[model samples]
Target: YKASIPKNGGPQIPDELEDPKAFKLKMETAIQATLKSEKAKGETYSQDEKELMIWYNYHFLGRGKPTTHIQVLSSVNNEQIKKNLPPVFKEIFARISSKLKHQS
Candidate 1:
């Protein structure tokens, strides 16, 4: 995903979010929140969730396709939440990217 983002000229993380664990935790929390909110509003899972579920089923479940709506709507609120991160959080992301490039 990071690789693809650069190809499109998207904003890069600075130096703060470089740790894989921190990145994963942040992403997970955001996705879970998105899923919960969508479920509450009865909007069904979003496009990103569909893509992720498809990948999970193919790789983890060894299936040709997703078999259940539950799996499709599992959890993507984390990503949605990320879309609305506060300014401080954005700075952290920028810092993470800068650190990756050794741009002290």
Candidate 2:
């Protein structure tokens, strides 16, 4: 959900979000043209889709354990997103650090 600024100093929107329609078009074109042309050996389309979903779940949802989440949130340097998230995610995110803060 966060985007690092590009080296060109342009507005930092992730490629996936920058122009979803364009991304979809590119994906469809690649699948229908390039791969078909190459006759690349790979899993079937349905199998590939399933594998992508599994990978997404593992990499995105699986890593959201509270401890890892805290570590990641604490490292954010984006003041705007950090500020915006605080009101919404504060209690959930603060459980660990707030405990430490109280103890200290």
Candidate 3:
């Protein structure tokens, strides 16, 4: 995992490593919330979850694949997330580009 610096430019510790059990709980809570919300919004929940799992798997599980021929990770700019992902996710729709990085 990338260690991130705070906006105040202060050093910070990643707490997820501090308590593995608590970290699992947090993961469960977030996933459950996503399940409920995604289901409510549309019929695409299963496909959505599949894509999410693939992206996260690449990030944390060392597995790789793009969803529906779309490279979702490359669509996100880490700097852009520093702005849009705060308060809540402002999802940027993926657009086809000749450029996108991937690892197989």
Candidate 4:
């Protein structure tokens, strides 16, 4: 899995996760937990895909945000890894998209 520093202040997972799949799962769980906890704290839940996309952009790209097309391309560079990433990212994206589809 590709590794990069997130732009926002938050906890960072360690780099020695060994298995990328497991690491991705952990990240997904952490994101959901953070969002859910935020919502529980009386934050208005914004169900906008664009906003989630931007969150992911900030977390991954760490620079001026890129378009969805560019982000997708960059996230999946190797053909083999690309095929695998869609399924993994899709699940995470689905959860995020469901929460933030309006921003799309």
Candidate 5:
């Protein structure tokens, strides 16, 4: 199974996450290399960030369902992800949260 992040409210498969374990391993490599990759860039990941990364990898990359995505998104403690991720990602999350809230 594979999970992905959406580039335009649609699925985007990251080449690095082709192998979940490999991606996880790559995440721990030297900061310089991570900085060179657009996926990681120069930012240092906190525990929350790491968890989100793993979860997303498993969810989108590993074929986790949309309902699961909704549940996870609803449960997320967004302060950290909101602060760390790009504005577009934050907006996307907000939109998903809003849509899910309205659905319930």
Candidate 6:
């Protein structure tokens, strides 16, 4: 299965995900290359395709809580979804985690 991070309201990728090194820039480059590839140009995905695949979209919350929150949509067990349908998206920042960050 494949996943994707939306351009808007997605996780806040810092200017420097790493230290002095530019991990964010590298990540963006990789993502762009993957998105703009010939294969992608030939077959650009649409929003309705979100049904069979996993998605990560962001939203703002009020109160003392964090300003932005991440959301996930994964419910393959649902009978409404066909079991034969496979994922058809590529993950960009889906595997990111706090442990990958270096606390300075």
TM-score of each: 0.24, 0.24, 0.25, 0.22, 0.27, 0.19
RMSD of candidate 2 to true structure, Å: 11.4
Instruction: Estimate the lDDT of model 6.
Output: 0.34
**Stretches of candidate 4 above 4 Å error?**
5-57, 60-64, 67-72, 88-104
* Top-scoring candidate (TM-score): 5
Q: List, residue by residue over 1-104, the lDDT tens digit for candidate 1.
A: 22222254432223334676754443344444434443332236574664354334333344223443344335436786578678899999999999989965
The predicted structure with the larger TM-score, 4 or 5, is 5
For each candidate, what is the lDDT?
0.47, 0.49, 0.41, 0.50, 0.54, 0.34
Q: Where does model 6 exceed 4 Å of error?
A: 1-21, 37-104
The per-residue C-alpha lDDT of model 3 at residue 101 equals: 31
Candidate 1 regions off by >4 Å?
Answer: 1-76
The pairs that clash in candidate 2 are none
lDDT of 4 by residue, 1-104 (tens): 12433365434443434676764544455445445443332235444442343355344444444554465566656775646675779788788989897777
**What lDDT does model 5 reach?**
0.54
Where does candidate 5 stray beyond 4 Å?
1-44, 64-67, 70-104
Residue 49 miss distance in model 3 (angstroms): 8.4
**Rank by lDDT (best first):** 5, 4, 2, 1, 3, 6
- State residue 23's C-alpha deviation in candidate 5, in Å: 10
lDDT comparison, 2 vs 3, better candidate:
2
Query: Which candidate number would show the highest lDDT if scored against the true structure?
Result: 5
Off by over 4 Å in 2: 1-77, 86-88
Error of 2 at 51 (Å): 21
Report lDDT (Cα) of residue 19, candidate 2.
88
Ranking by TM-score: 5, 3, 1, 2, 4, 6
Worst 10 residues of 5 by lDDT: 1-10
Evaluation by TM-score, superior candidate among 1 and 4: 1
Residue-level lDDT of model 2, residues 3-96, one tens digit each, is 3323553222225578877655444444444345445433466645533433333334445546545655666767865676755477777887
